[model samples]
Target: MKIDKGISLTKVELDRIEANFLAAWTGDNSTPFIVDAPISASLRTRGTAIVRQTNLYTLFQLCPTLATWAVLTPLAIDYGASNKNVYSHISVFTNKNFDDAQAREKLKERFRFAARRIGLPVVGNQPTELFFAPLGPARSQLPDMARAFVGAALHLGPPAVEDTPSARDWQRRAVATRCPNLTRLNATISFDRSAYCARRFEAWRRGNEPLTEAEALLFAAYDQAVIGFGRHRSDLVAPPRLFWNGFTLALEAEPSQSAQSIKLGPFPTQLPGGSQVAIRTPWPEKITWTAGSIAQDIEVAPASDEILVFDADSGVLLTRTALETKVIAVASERQVVIASEQFGVTSFGPSIQSADPGRFIAWTITGDELNFPGRLPPWDHITSRDGALDQCRLDRPRRNAYSFGVGWRVDPQNRSRCRRPNQNSPRTIR
Candidate 1:
């Protein structure tokens, strides 16, 4: 036999090299050295695995490869802007199987299962449905899962559902159930529909069926929540206005007309419990609000920390804060009089009596003095008919001041006070 030394290899040496290669391939490095060669090779292996998978089972068998692709594709592929590549791959896989529906259903079931584990909902059951459907233990329990999914989409946002026939059917059912008339009256301002709704309210008002105070308010407010009517133009619902009863009670306990004008410095701050907050508005009807989910109505008191007045159109988010609850008392139709002792700043501990009203009219009490006070009358003096004391007014002839204190003996009348605090005075009279 002609023996070629070059071709002759001992089993021991062959085995030794094979062992080292296998160790490296299996991610066991003999030394602490890192090699780019192995990483590139590993990526090639993953890419090939994704391309070669014939079915969901095989695809799952290559889960490590699939997961690797899932992470790298968003970076390596222009997948976010366009999902054509992934969709094409799925289509090809589905086509290879004789029954497309079965293949798709299997894939969806698996993929949705995975999505739910990661907090994302599955898109849909149909190929055309391009939106994601949220996963839930009882998502399918709803009368129409797809419609519930669509309604959830509208409410929460991010139309992750596919625009498939089944998804559309689901959306139709959901819309019919939740807000049957909302779609028909998308942006209507006419009171036609409101007038219809009012009939139900009129029934409730006429005692045909008793309603809770909140339910009644919601009924009336819903009728008024139109774009061109009732103080606002949007139909967004706001949370009920909130007033801490404990805080209001504290202010009520103080002497009458004991409107404490504490000024909170030049910033917003959370007041302690029992601080008075007085909100005001001209809507004539009281607004109901909920704090942290407990429903309550705004009240005319002084102990609440911060009063929020909601405009009827927009929901609670559009509520404006007021410095005081005092308004021009509607005692006579011919004229209106203002009241002194406005609510003070919420951010700091000073009243307008001690601090400048600042440039922010929103932050200042309504009756407080400012550079160009809106609708402000002038401030003047009025001699007490008893000839004992004098009162101040926002315009002239103090009509009302300290009805609970020294000025109480002067006039039972209430009017805005324009008395500038004496710069050198710092007396706290009991």
Candidate 2:
């Protein structure tokens, strides 16, 4: 398909995708780890995870900040540069299994009509539909599961579902209809087909035990994760936990000597009598797990000795949210994360009700939404003022220095300001 147009559709697609990329510069030592920020074009973000000769998983973690455009632009070019005639990149997620050819064609027609209305091409490229095969006998659906997660990153806004009573009711029914158990995995220690690694991993995850084998591996070759698009992470020395006093969602951890992050549930559940909560990989850290029935798994490193807050409100993993609460710091080994005053796990668990045994993956829900499915995405809350892409900006201003307070940017001048990298926003996060 050749066209005499003002600009190539490929260029249009790249602009649209990059428009949603949110980034900001931080204070003096704000984001020291993103040292390659200036050279993201040459950044190698993906890796092969293997042992001996076994390819377990493909691991990649790319931040969505301005620097990341170096990586995305080429991929967009390649995709659009393909045999033109259809918008193969756009896809829909569904778990339905079609049985009849007639039904399939009808659905295809309907799908294409929707696509056309949205200005997408009708044919000549990859298949338009992405099917999430239902869990067969032993949960043979990791690839499908991973695709849902990766696909999820492409969308913005609440699902068409509303907060009305009927929506909540149906969502409740859906939740009750159990999805199969997430395959249990032990990426670390004594893992063999007959390794009993799952049982041992659970034991250690719940109750610390004296280990006889080599220190359990922190992650497995099958493990993989991607953190970006406004998400952030920090390390903590203590165990990660979500406890609630009703007034606020509280995170408390003790000081630990170990210098690594702890792995918590990719599984979700909240505390006793508290707002819905779950453990996630602390920010900046990413891992993909063959054992994960969901998107990715996290290991909280223990070096920083400060616990960071993660926002599950939007349903995206490890993204940032406003730290509106108070933090309190106490004596050695004892810390309270209330409100700086800045910053700062628990078991592999459900902390679940006894009545529900079949569910391994509990979702993150809000207090007022009444146990409905998750609404906000990790990046959805980030809104551009002009109601388009790239315009989303978070500008944080001055907080006094020396307090170790409100520092999140870097600049050429006072270096106290933060601005969205690629987007045209003067706002900074400090």
**lDDT (10s digit) by residue, model 1, range 266-351:** 43223233344443232112333322222323332212222332222221121222222122121121211111233223232233
lDDT tens digits by residue: candidate 2, 334-404: 11121111110111112232111211122222111111112221222222333232111112223211112
Question: lDDT score, residue 327, model 2?
Answer: 18
- Which ranges in model 2 have alpha carbons more than 4 Å from their true place? 1-106, 112-125, 128-139, 142-239, 242-250, 253-430
TM-score result, candidate 1 = 0.21
**Native-structure RMSD, model 2:** 24.0
- Count of backbone collisions within predicted model 2: 36
